[model samples]
Target: MKEKQFTTRAVHAGERADFSQINSVVTPIYPSVGYTFADSHELDAVLGGEQPGYVYSPRYANPTVAALETAVANLESAEAAIALPSGMAAVHLALLGAGVRAGSHVVVAADIYGATYSLVQGIFTELGATVHLVDVLDLKKIEAILAQEKVSALLVETISNPLMKVADLPKLAELAHVHHAKLLVDNTFCSPYLCNPLTFGADMVIHSATKFIGGHGDVMAGLVATSAELKAEMVRLNKLLGSSLGPFEAWLAHRGLKTLPLRMRQQCQNALHIASWLQTHPKISQVNYAFLPSHPQFELMNQLTNGKGGGAVFSFEVRGAGKPEIFALMDALELIQPATSLGDIYSLTLYPAISSHRSLTPAERHKLGIGDGLLRLSAGIEDVADIQADLAQALNKIGHGFDG
Candidate 1:
């Protein structure tokens, strides 16, 4: 079969719509729990793995979930895919399947999502893996870590959460291959529509699909896309750990995925518009969006972003404004939602230090360059002028020595 373009792939791939039965034009939700076999030989084949068949129970495998996996794998252009209960579950399953053993060592980027950081620092470390936090932007620092540490795997996000920093995937992939370590990229921020990490030599790509794939703040799911060999391992680990996503959630993710290309591009446009407006606002501090010319790594961002934009998520410091002042501004905003999670159609904002990375100590946060007054914004598909006006109003009303 010929490879389809991005728009065609997004809408047509894995869309096994049944148009004849009940005249349904979309993929049907297979709300089944068990499958009936024809004879003893079929049952034996399923048990022995001689043939591919669904058996035992629905939690392990369901038709609806299978469609979701196919849809996600197609989006990522990977050999196979799996749907987990949540994005974090996909991360855990991907790591475990990649042979992250008790004595294994991992090199995690410093600007990783806070929950991901805690996972590496607390859980992975406790499990005997020596997790090294790396400054991904500093190639020399990454090289130093790779040379000294016995890194079995290197993990980082395409765009680091809150920080909105982009990792040099090609450089990192080369380094990982040289050191015989698997390169894992969390592509939750810039989905396949923006960049394909595998094309750039990444070994594994994982996502908290709940963000982009769900696209509407309604579902919680995760997806791991990789080579056939790695996907087989992930499947084994997923079944062993019972991290499979529910059928309904998988269906929701698949439903949302069909509109992914349209939604992401719109969100990207809106984000750039808002980010540019914020840069000129006197009350705003430093906005860390790659789309803006003032960004330190604008050149590098252009290379990774492919002109699609700096993604819908970004962060900005409120200068001398403290946590209380920041909270007041966030709460006063009528259009923007003051909540956790992003990639939804509605604008969502959160204080990183207290919300996303609350587990990190003050020293650790300072080391990672996250500030108490920093605000992370997930720009949505709302009208740019309307959103800007609300933010402007909020900043104006709160006058607690607010960064002006």
Candidate 2:
């Protein structure tokens, strides 16, 4: 229990116990909204958190969901983990757990996923939190804000959205601790397989399990891995917020997680090949995969992933392609899915300006270097050659105006 390989932990962690006495190979789903106890005293004990048992679904917890949480915690090497209905819910819970209340200060990455950007700037701000959007790479600026304000949390993505900027986790964690701010990393892009943010001193490691964790796109769930104290706080908050993941979704996510190591290895391999191919293509002006030597944070990425290749997801810019041309290319693709989500068995593509970053204004997006021609791709565990050929044909169709 003290030491296990990542792949072994992936398949075996948080399973084969607790919920069943029948030695079920898989974690069984407990769909009941409430649980029965031996007696009222036992129920009261469980309800008061004096003992470990599920009493309710929405407010308290469920066996299936708890199993998933345990697995995620084990994988991320955290004291505990909580599963939520969606990734945004996990983000919300992490913010609250980090003490992002009214009159609090929060420093967030400017280039994060669009919904996260809106949540910090919109809802958190409306609730009276002073949010500062900064370039996560600029540690000095972040430090300055943290020093000046009583910042509650410093939120950032391990790998930035639309642009594969690798965050220096250890440095950021140190800076946040120095300023008494909690470092909360959204580890969705890298997953537990590629990077364990908590190991680098992050106070909270969050995941949109719907993506890479689920790996099949059938479930919508989120998870937060942190110290047991933080998890307790989130669980208490969830009692009132009611954003916990359902048992069925939890089961689905848990099942998908069993193959995380396997799926990630192939996805990473496919992405590396595709990103390299895209970089050399005349139709691609830029490819933002962190593992590539050309990437700005290639070294940092290798340091973080131990040279596992950037990740399954990466972004690129099409040569002379605007929204219209981007649409043309996506339409021409036969194998790759022109969908919104990523980290599935099938390849997926999204136009950041229209999808993930759509909430931001054109000027705001351009300021963040998310051009209209930018496209985000999540490589699947498919044949690299087939995937490459799909992109090749798509580029050919959108070849009306090219650098060549």
Candidate 3:
């Protein structure tokens, strides 16, 4: 048989077609927290890793969660995958599983998600790991850092949060491998539909399944895809930390995966349309969408995403505005919700200064080009014209300046 297409696999992968007891078309949510053993022999065999069956605890593995993990692993072309309670949990486990420890050296991208920056700078640093944050686009600087320090893992995002900068995954992976370091990618922005970091030589791929994977915004989950050996370590760590995904959330994430290909396609179309329109608006200072030809990494994005239009989220700077004006614009929006989350069925917008990047100091945000007027928009599967109307009216509200 020929290899199935992405959409086909998305719908059918990890499905057990040969179920005997009441075959349901959809995968049923196995809410059982623990699986029973036939006898003591079976339990011992399963516990000792001599048999192929689920253990007594959901933390070790739940049938529903396992199905979701398998589906994501198949999509990512990874050896195995582990599902967790949240994105940050996946990040913490990935770093720890990839051998990041006290007194270890790690390299990370400067323009990463704010929470990620906090985790590395605060938690990891407190644990005695020295993290070198650099602009990943600057190959020379990365090389200099690698030359100076024995790095454990080179962490980066496929498409940076808010800023939408595209990382050169293949090149970064090569650099990491040469220095005996692993390349760990946070693939939440791109998702498996847009990009697969493992295919490009990443040692591990992390996703905030809460965002794109759980497209409806109802469920919160995270996933880490890696080689079998690393996956075992992640699973062990997840079990020990008690951060495994609940069966219900795992089922929701799996259902969300079925429509990922469709959702992602529409999202890319909507983002391109909205980004192009925003660029022409006089009130907009700069747009940070890679699909725009004017973007710095346009070519790289095209090459990496295979012309998928830079996923669904982008950030743009509002001209002549500060926090007050930006707040007014958000308040005036009727269609686009002023929320902190992304990749939902409804269009959403967030203010980076007070939301995603609020962890950083004002000076630090300024250094990273995240200004008070910068707004990150997550284009939803809405009518392009309607989305534009909402954005235009909001911009108009801020155009005349805040009267109060």
Candidate 4:
């Protein structure tokens, strides 16, 4: 064979190097948009789904992303998994995969993530789908709604955001299956380390891998774990929507997932300690940690997680405090950072009224038991004493009599 020219060499210098003999401890990132095959026949076979291979990234898949999907599927005990650009994309794809479409009926938890609420109430509703937002804990109401309509999907968070309300997954799954509806559970809070929703009979398990899965808070990704049949459908839908996870982000998330058990263990311990301490504090009006006996769904949470832990995040109310006082407490904190996100290595605080549940009106928030004085704290793998000290000092700085 003749040597290539300089210009041709520039484009083909390191293209398609074979590493089949190389064994690496970690998965390497594959950034190529297009892949090559030994012959056109093999390429045709791969593209036609007759063989397991990657062709194009945006339309098909990537090696790194596929590795992450496999890992998540194994962790969640699902037959297959799919990675997405973000948590909302996972939710949207899960809904679509469950056969939600125009003229479909979707039953959603009333107090879900703010953006998710808007996604169903605004976009799905505008598309002519009927959405019924009901209390997920009220199984009777859900049964009645299912009986009254031909529902397509029932969506709920395993441990709801901001408030930390645990859903009855087993019962909900049974109800949905009996009604011929698919049940999709957001397992972001109770990660696979604590709970596997698929084992509890859920049709689909969703995760915002940007949270605990990417423990360091560096990568943004989402995941859906389900049967292979459903995964193929989601893959097809995503090919048209172009909401696939990137190779770099997939590599980062996969690395983060390796330490999920360790991170979640310490974070859960710290969260329970903080929740217990806050209950004893005079300024704290309410505490909402499922591990605590005070939580309404404590028993159900234990059954779901098998007492692994109550997760790393919980919400509490500051007595006689509104936005102004809440702001003062947040500003007073030194060790605990006041941030918008949760499930990171750094202990952080978020006010639901302005962050997680901001989309809902005050009346709607209040109706769901999310008050203006509520503050959510995500306990990191830090010392419990240090975290409580920061909260104590912050609480002491703000006076209860302050009005907003």
Candidate 5:
């Protein structure tokens, strides 16, 4: 069909376009543990990597996962994609596959997921690689950092969790390429629907498919998108490390993929509405959705959100609040779940200082700008008014026990 468009390919690629296996439009999961080979020649070809087909264990490459990877890769316009058990696996594979070695320098943003920050700072740092943290938006500082250090790769989120900082993908890509360093964009926050880092010259794109790509928060999965050469290395390392996404999780992820477009659009709209309302709310100290006019990155967001709202996550500081007040408001919510993870059908909220980013030292938190009183909101499918009502009630009773 000469299909080259994002939506078209997402629905068609890495799958039997007809999906007539059972007269279903969505791709069906192949739950078999292993595939039966027609003959030894065929089996040899499959094992030898001579042809693309499954013959052995499903974990190596399940039809469902292949379909999911193909769809995501096509949507992101990448050469190949790898699906893993969780987002951490995806990040680990990308860093490992990029050929990071002892004495290599890895550059990361300070405002990363808490676990990831620990992994890079705690493990990779000990393994002989140097870690450099910078605000991804600070091009001047990034340039200076790159100029001073021989960085192996640059890693950042497309739109960061809680913070909603949008990286300048094109500029970062140029900077990386100039220094022979690779750029890996963690697309967990925005996913392919909002931004494809590959289209901007990023060497790789990582996703904790556990987030928006899975849509329903029903499964934990990770994905790596990169060039063919990179994919081969990742696959090799993935197999060696004994980290593979299970067949069932792969199936669930495939199902998740089918509705990513629809889910993301709705969530994006809901988040914008919520962020806008929160900005004007008297109880809010700061609203951080990129689409918000008050956001420092509003102009950049307009240029990069592709006319879509920044994918549904943002942080709002509680006005006149310390840790106790923030906790009170979070606990007061009725509909919104006071949760840690984000990107789901149901709304979720958390305080990074106490939740995800708590592990970091005070100095680290200071550098990352993770405030103690911050309340992050993950807008969901609920009506914006309902979400606001939950928050209003929560806020109403926040200072009720004492004084405002």
Candidate 6:
């Protein structure tokens, strides 16, 4: 048979044959913490990696989590994938799996998620790894840093958070390979439905399944897709670190993946419409969405995303407004929810200053162009007109004060 389309794979890729008595269409959740071995010989073989079978502990692998891993791996075109408890766990394990050890040097994008920034600066640095945080948009600067440092890995986001800066993944991958460094991309923002970094030469693709992959914002999970060798290494580290995802959450994430292509398409459409509307509004000073022509990486985004537009998220600045006005605007919204997590069925807005990037100091945030007036919008599957109306009314409140 010919290769199945993306939507088809999203729906059926990792499902097993319906051999049970019930013969359900959906993969049933296996919540058992332990699986009994058939015999001692089988247990030993499985533990020693000589055979393919489950052992006693869920940490080794749960059927549901393995299904999630397989589905994500197929989506990413990776040799294998491992599901974790959260996105941070996946990032940490991916770095370690990619050979980031004590005394190793790594290069990370300066404008990444705040928790990621803290991970490198606070945790990895303490482990004896030297980290160089640079503006990844400037290839010259990255090359300069690579020349001076013996880096083990180059980490960056597929589409940066809040700022919506799209990285040139292929170029970065080339640079990392030339420097004998592995390229690790945080694909949480774009998701595999929108962009697969591994297909563009990234050594590993990481996702916070808590967001797009889960779709509903209920499950907290993460995934790392990579070469088979790295997958093994990450699984080993995952076992040692005890970062295995629960069977229930993994099942939920798997259920979410079945509709990822559908949800992502609607979300992307909504984002494009809302972003375009915001761009023309006098109350908005700037809109940062890769699909917008004004975006510095618009052409690159088109090429990378296959002209589908940026993913579901974009950020815009309220004209002449400070934190007070931004808060009032968020409070005035009737439909759009004021929240932190994204990729839900309902439109949600987040303030980077207080939420995703709050770990960064004020000076650091300002340097990265994440101003107090900037608000990140995660467009949902709602009718574009209704979403636009909510935003317009909120902006009006910002103009006339909260009382009006």
Computed on alpha carbons, the lDDT of every model, listed in order, comes to 0.84, 0.92, 0.90, 0.92, 0.83, 0.89
Residue pairs whose backbone atoms clash in candidate 4: none
RMSD of 1: 8.5
TM-scores, all models, native as reference: 0.92, 0.94, 0.94, 0.98, 0.91, 0.93
If both were scored by lDDT, which would come out higher, candidate 3 or candidate 4? Answer: 4
Q: Pick the candidate with the highest TM-score.
A: 4
User: What does candidate 2 score on TM?
Assistant: 0.94
Tell how far residue 375 is off in model 6, in angstroms. Answer: 0.4
Question: For every candidate structure, what is the RMSD over all alpha carbons to the true structure, in angstroms?
Answer: 8.5, 8.4, 8.5, 1.3, 8.4, 8.5
Cα displacement (angstroms), candidate 6, residue 379, comes to 0.3
Q: Which ten-residue region of model 2 has the weakest summed lDDT?
A: 14-23
Comparing 2 and 3 by lDDT, which wins? 2
- Model 5 segments more than 4 A misplaced: 1-24, 400-404
Error of 1 at 189 (Å): 0.5
State in Å the error of residue 117, model 4.
0.4
Q: Is candidate 3 or candidate 4 better by TM-score?
A: 4
Model 4 residue 147 distance off true place after TM-score fit, in angstroms: 0.6
Question: Model 6: per-residue lDDT, tens digit, 1-404?
Answer: 99999999999786665545786677778876655566888878888999987774469888878888999999999999999899999899989998999999999999999899999999999999999998879899898878788989999999998899999999999998998899999999888988889889999999999999999989999999999998888877878788889889999999999999999999999999899988899888899998888899999999888887699999998887778989889999999999879988789998999998898889999999998789999999989999999998878766765222
Give model 5's TM-score versus the native structure: 0.91
Off by over 4 Å in 1: 1-24
Q: What tens digits encode model 3's per-residue C-alpha lDDT throughout 1-404? A: 99999999999797655456787888888886666677999989998999988874469888889899999999999999999989989999999999999999999999899999999999999999999999879899998888889999999999998788889999999899999999999999898998899989999999999998999999999999999999988777777788878889999999999999999999989999999999999888889998899999999888888877689999898887899888888899999999879998889999999988899999999998898889999999999899999998878766675332
Error of 6 at 125 (Å): 1.1
lDDT of 4 by residue, 33-85 (tens): 99889899999999899998889984589999999999999999999999998
Q: Which stretches of candidate 4 lie over 4 Å from their true place?
A: none
Candidate order (lDDT): 4, 2, 3, 6, 1, 5
